[model samples]
Target: MASDSLHSTVHQQPSPNLTSFPIILKFEEVVYKVKPDHRGLCRGRSSWSSTEKTILNGITGMVFPGSIKRRTGFVAQDDVLYPHLTVSETLIFTALLRLPNSLTNNDKIAHAERVITELGLTRCRNSIVGGALIRGISGGEKKRVSIGQEMLINPSLLLLDEPTSGLDSTTAQRILTTIKGVARGGRTVVTTIHQPSSRLYHMFDKVVVLSEGRCIYNGPASAAMEYFSSIGFSTSITLNPADFLLDLANGIAPDPEHASEQSEGLEQERKLTREALISAYDKNIAPKLKLEISNSRMDIYSFNKHASSRNDPTKAEQWCTSWWYQFKVLLQRGLKERRYEAFNRLRIFQVISVAFLGGLLWWHTPESHIQDRVALLFFFSVFWGFYPLYNAVFTFPQERRMLIKERSSGMYRLSSYFMARTIGDLPLELALPTAFVFIIYWMGGLKPHPVTFILSLLVVLYSVLVSQSLGLAFGAILMEIKQATTLASVTTLVFLIAGGYYVQQIPPFIAWLKYLSYSYYCYKLLLGVQYDEEDYYECSNGVLCRVEDFGPIKSMGLNQLWVDVLMMALMLVGYRLVAYLALRRVR
Candidate 1:
């Protein structure tokens, strides 16, 4: 019955009284040009020398809407969803932001429920929308969920790109059937698909074939083979109509009368090239299209109905939601996703492994052997600095695509996402280093006083945060994990060399590099907390001790401890600011 109604609607003549609301999307002589890559540093090229490709050239078509709404939704090829959020949570978040503030929470949820039922996703509504690393709903269900997301806004026209790219035939058919039901109920849906099955091909009312970005055919799906044959192409009853049409567009279709023969002469005689097809379409179809466009405009102008405008009552509302609401939602989602990643079992094991090994190697350092204490303190600074720095290099790069999708959709502000991410990982960032310090500090038999122990832990924690921020900045700036990791390693190595411990005799020209070294400040602060001036260090029996008075802190001037602390704090803010700027530039 639904298919019959859809068929009838397609063949039916345009009438103003046919439906209370009708929308027609029309584009005349549309041309889309691809911009050249601008990342290169080439200023010598002349403006007249161009290298831009045209994807769509002078194509004109009209997509008439069944309902009287202008709400259009687009589902991209990639299924961009928050992997951690469940299906219900995903739709609810979209509804909360996209639906007008006039709707109550219950009303919004009820609408979401209706869409889930309509799309046959009720069984998986509570399931997580996982990614490659995790298990979640099936691909078919995920596609449906993606569609259901758009349904919450009640769009009149829904555009989809390759909706069945990865699904099995049965699943693809089911998805198409669901979409057909939507079209039958007075909605205009335009979807692009790669080679679909014969049954699936017939499901569409009209078919448009393009070759090398040029439309060669646009007509009823049933009449496509006849149209191609009329244009000196060949087809067979045994062949899938879609396959035949595609081959015809690609200039590979066999002769209709002589299946075993290929004819170049006929192609030349018919002017069978992309240019010829485009020209033929203009001459043969443009007249019909102009009439269709004129009729659609007349029907649309007959009545002035703006259902979509009222449907989205908050169209004039700023920022989708209140500032606090966006922040709260983003914070909750970030924390949930980061909790799984930051405290991964492998990371915990690695931290513990390092701590235990360091503790055993430096066990019970004697007070007279002050050299061991200094080495251990420097190790503390470098370990936390290096570990967190490399670990964070992958964070932003991994989430970049997801960030781009959300930002393009106008989901939230870049500032909000940057702030939330920086703040979200603080728990694990502080926790891991503190735990590592607790295990090693007592085991190495360092300063055991309560104030000394607490201060040491605080210093290590702050150092880890600084490293994490640097990692974020590098990841955001590079936007690729491999490149960012390589650069981060080199940058961290340079800082380590200038950290005041490894190379004490700094040349005057490069002495300014020490101020930029996060490890330098952290090392100075940790040393200050451990030892002071006038402390005596007795050399062990038959052993030579370095020229340390056991007061590594006083030697560097005790007043500089606060300055080091202040510097590390400033670097934290500085790195985060840089990361934010990099993200803004990327968008």
Candidate 2:
């Protein structure tokens, strides 16, 4: 019931900086469940089973605010940030999307700067928030940057999940102290800390200890040890209260069964202590919260009435900016990030090496060996098909977390992001294939006429586009790089087999599969472009031999060339459409 009030307040907030009465966050019988394990499958059954595990068991508690605003912010356990963006850029972007439109760019920038100062990130304001592949700010600074993003929204209620995780004791203490300072400024700060030091544990105003999805204690932090001791769990004055409480909650306690005993007695003692603690909370705390729920509803009635009319305009659920604005920002960010990829030495080397090797292998063969030319054309088709697809398969999965976070934040529409990324990647996608073809075409001794050469390049480029689109779809659907890669490889191999190359016979049932394979169309189109009109190939003994009028393209027919081109174009559009739809369903 209290969460309903909190939800309404959050949606009806007028602006980032606006403040009303202090808000309360209460969860009554709130439970979160998942399908047994992360994989959503029954472990030991042949048939599918519908079983669930509760992560938070009927969690009922209150996060009563000491501040006058329901601007609740959540900082996730892991930092979700763009590796390329500078600290200033990251904060400014978040502010632009979250702060009211009435605030000018200058105002947003000022707000972001203020957050930087408040979070002690001023020294690293311009530094990149780098990730595993890149080096930038230290871990503490990155955590502060995560906090600064939320700070830009000026939230009065902050919930952080292990904000100090993976940090050194000093850094963790510093971060906790900063959080304590924030709490002292009249904000309600709740965090789920793990294995905190004694100094760190003592900093909290209140601590809610949970065990196996049940609340074992919900009271003042200073009084936790006393309460546990009162319930028959021994404590040392020298022992860290936080550690003692955790050990008591987890079934780890001092036992007399030392050297060779089974310690079943210790296990029984722990089970009893756990049950006792659970019963203690149910008897002591839940009744008070239940009583408060009714009383607070009556007290906040007048405040709710006054706030409703003032907050309605912002409650309509519109995006921060126009679709066009979102598209422009996303496109700009995509292009800036791709600039680093365009200069990747390894990719450049791979493309050049493959092109040169293909050229050397197929160098200047006379027209007599028509199959050699066909092989060269097929090689081009298969290479472009596999290469771009391979590259695209990693795109979404690599950026999945970032996309989900930003999209969830209402930063932009999925359509805006999808379109911007597709458009932004066009140049790099087109450049590599064109260059590869250029180097190999003249050296391999294919038709040199301008129209034919241009046609060949366009066909190959379109093939690359189709491959890349499929890759995007794979990445979005799989959401894991390794899985997507494996699936893409298998699918590409199937397409390659059905690509009208190695198979001399096709089963009637699967004959139509060639239409689904872009490689098939690409190869056909390339052969038609290069050798459709050529009539002869030189004999092995150096004499010219008579060949068919239409060369190797005779079997497929010249009309099918246009059909292949049309199909390649269709596949380009179809794959991208599928990719977009897959992305839309990701979360």
Candidate 3:
């Protein structure tokens, strides 16, 4: 059989000089399955019950020693990177977070620099890894950056999922050449490619072709055409070997002798051809591969034990850096990533425009216009309430994919990430509100007391935090941007209506909701800051009336100022706790 010849050739080939830590990857009877449609709609069923869909059925093979997941570097097809970060910054952060703590910061950075040079990214090292919205690095450079991230750990085995995908032929060739260089460094590189060109196909030492979740061919790339030809699937035209193999895998062959067939017949022929190829592989190749695996001295378990005894760097602790260190790095990264969004001109314009509009409308009204003053204060509560809510709502959803990728790689503790994210945004979140309060409070001319203005600023800032917390909670709980924003919209509207501004005499059944609204407390506190219970204002009839006797002010007195502050504080902590817990549940 052709398998015997292929096996002999493979065994007779001389081993190249490998590095100290060469990894050989082997698998036997690896069965992988998943439920494709959880709702069972694919099977014409309305229930949630679903059947298992086999993706890899009894897959068996090996790449020269074996591979451990921890020691294996994986680069996903899509590059999930912070658009704001430069290529150097991206690799540096990854190295700091992913490398073992045994190494010093300088050593980690040095390693990153080496990887940058090795990956030919020195020229564009400072260029940002841009996303859909931003234009930064080229596609090839981004892919290399993704690879360089994995290379930071110096993995023995590197697994890349379509690393060359979406690149042109020249760029794809360069990427493959880089990977080949990596493989030459005693690392086993396994990648999945689709319809590679002839030049690309020849670069691979070994190739495995699968048909309907079954191995149709598992041998050297150079010998693939010969093996197929021996199995009555030869081609005369000088087609790319990868293309030919793909055609064979799809149950088609380039044969001028055969006539053009109908669609139905072609499908049946393809099925039959696939079955024949699978059967041939089972009979010819499976036995030899199984025997080789059985004869291997170092199995996966023994290799792992040996690796553990050696105290390999790849098998280091789950978290490489301390919580504080992680927090510090992530905090810096978050600040850099969000600086543009936080301080953008458009956002600044929106806040300043609204602040000035409110200032101009209220424009230093006298103390006699208590109602207008109260309206302005309520507007402050409502504006700050939803503004931060909408802005913070997109936080978790936007970073969800990036979080999942990094966390799965065990980059940092979720606590550090959560803390850094929320805390780093504090200054940015408060900046606009601080400016708004300063502008409107001075322009509206309500309560000329210095202490009163300071108190109002403090309350507005406090309200900003509470509103941002609630938005974060919604975002973390529902990691869908549209859904979270919608929920936030509904929630803020409810709080606005129930904040006791437009309606003072809320029904007893729903009066409890006002207590739940942070805006209600903030509004009451602003009024308390402006006037005392005994302070009098001229009514519409020129009668002097106690300021606290107004309907809204009377109902919400200053006696519960401490209670209101306490509630706001509780909400500040409570919502954040909810957000953190919800984030924990994310996979």
Candidate 4:
């Protein structure tokens, strides 16, 4: 078989610098299990019960780092890059947020560029690392970028979970080759692979095969087939070495053509079980492997102690960068990432169309038409009320995975990230609302005084902030899009109904509920801005009636304008505080 010849010719040797700094990762008799919920009839008993399921039973192995320090890097199966960011921007941002503050920004950027070149991503470095919806880099290029993100830290021990899982055979080979180069540079790379091709399998210096939560083989890749063959299981056909090992681990015997000379026991050998293979391994291999591990412990301990005493220049601080630095980097990244969504062409068109339509509907309304003017003001409040709410509701749910991944790596503090998101969204969230109010207030012929216009604008903007904070709170608390959106819909509907414009005299029992709605306060404040206590308009009989005496205005007059502002301010701060606390409790 090709695998046989390749295994004999291929040998992996560590770099000559290995002797200077060795890092040995050793784990012994590791066992892991999980409790599964079984909520059905089991063994003819109609009862619910929980049972322990074993995933790894007494597994033991070690990954030998040739000459490396004590840093570790991990890559998950799914690549979690921002779809809007180019490859160069992605790595540069990661470097800025994660690299030590001792290094200047230019130095960190240069390091990211070096990683780009090393990963062969220069061609696509300027391309966006797109997602399922966005089209940018290819699968291979994205996988390489994921690896480069981890490599920025210069980790001595790299752990990857199924790095080549969804790639083609050729692309998978290239990934493994890159990993091999990393190993050759005196670092240790450990990865989990299933059913690799013959050539790919031969590249590994060591192989650890497991079946049914137990280690079946742990030794040099070149010696695996030989070790299995010694136990009366040799393949007669030319098969991939990985395939042959899988067949044995599955308890399927070799072909009849390669059976033992004893014909009487042929059938028994063909039906070999996992227990028999495990027994053979225990008897023949366990003793020598255990002895080697025991002997190496002392050497590994002494080396680690000596290395810790030296002043290693590459060692990073516990937090890597200061809190303010993290905030600035995260703020810049958030703004760049959300710019498109905030100023989307479709959204801008929709807002402009609504503004023009509202302006034309109530164009040049007169002061005598008090009800018409009040309705226009209330519409303003309602539009801004829900516009920012729906947009802000999706903020945290969409970024849940990315946030968890980055935070797990200790890249930044929750405070820094939260503050950046809050501040970065200010201009984007407030822009369209400001435009809407300016257009409609003048067209609808509300109070012509400059002070009234400015106050009205401020109230509308304040209401927008309060509404957005509520949405953010819902999103952070639930972290599920469907649930958060549904809750937001119900809450906004309730607030709209309780708002003074729709029902000036709410039932006494539900009157207290109006106080809980920011919409009610915003509507009252808008009315106070456009009218005064002594302002009057011609009544139906040509008699003068005080504008504040109008039904909607009378119910909520300018007398409590300051109180309404205070309430709106409290809601703004209170909702955001709730959102922050909810985010802290996540994961």
Candidate No. with top lDDT? 3
Candidate 4 lDDT by residue in tens digits, 102-162: 6789878988898888889999999988889989998888889989887777666777788
Q: Which candidate is the best by TM-score?
A: 3
Comparison by TM-score, 2 against 3, better one: 3
> What value does the lDDT take at residue 402 in candidate 1?
75
- Rank order by TM-score, top first? 3, 4, 2, 1
Give the poorly placed runs of model 3, Cα more than 4 Å off: 1-22, 34-52, 65-70, 297-302, 312-316, 540-542
CA lDDT for candidate 1: 0.75
Reference-based lDDT, residue 334, model 1: 78
Off by over 4 Å in 2: 1-22, 31-55, 66-72, 229-236, 251-262, 504-509, 531-551
lDDT of each: 0.75, 0.76, 0.83, 0.81
**Model 3 lDDT on a 0 to 1 scale:** 0.83
1-587 per-residue lDDT for model 2 (tens digits)? 01111222221223344443355666787788777534555677545437777787867777766232225677888999888888988888777666666677677778787777777888888888888989989898888888877666666678788898999999998898777666655556778888788998888777788877788877778888777777666644478777787786786653434322457866777777678878888887778867877677765676567767575434645765677867887887777666767658898889989999999999986676677887898899999999989989988998888887777666678888898988888888898889999999999998889999999998899888889999998888888999999999898999989877777367889898877889988988887777544456675676665444334455444455667778788888888898898889876
CA-only RMSD, every prediction: 5.9, 4.8, 4.6, 5.3
Q: What TM-score does model 4 achieve against the real structure?
A: 0.89
**lDDT tens digits, residue span 359-456, model 1:** 99999888766778888999999999998889889878888877876676566778877877778878888888888999999989898899999989
Query: What would the per-residue lDDT of candidate 3 be over residues 300-411, giving only the tens digit for each residue?
Result: 5687577678755444555667899999989988888877777899989999999999999999988898889999999989999888989999999999999988887788
Cα-based lDDT at residue 301, candidate 4: 78
For residue 352, what is the lDDT in candidate 3?
Answer: 98
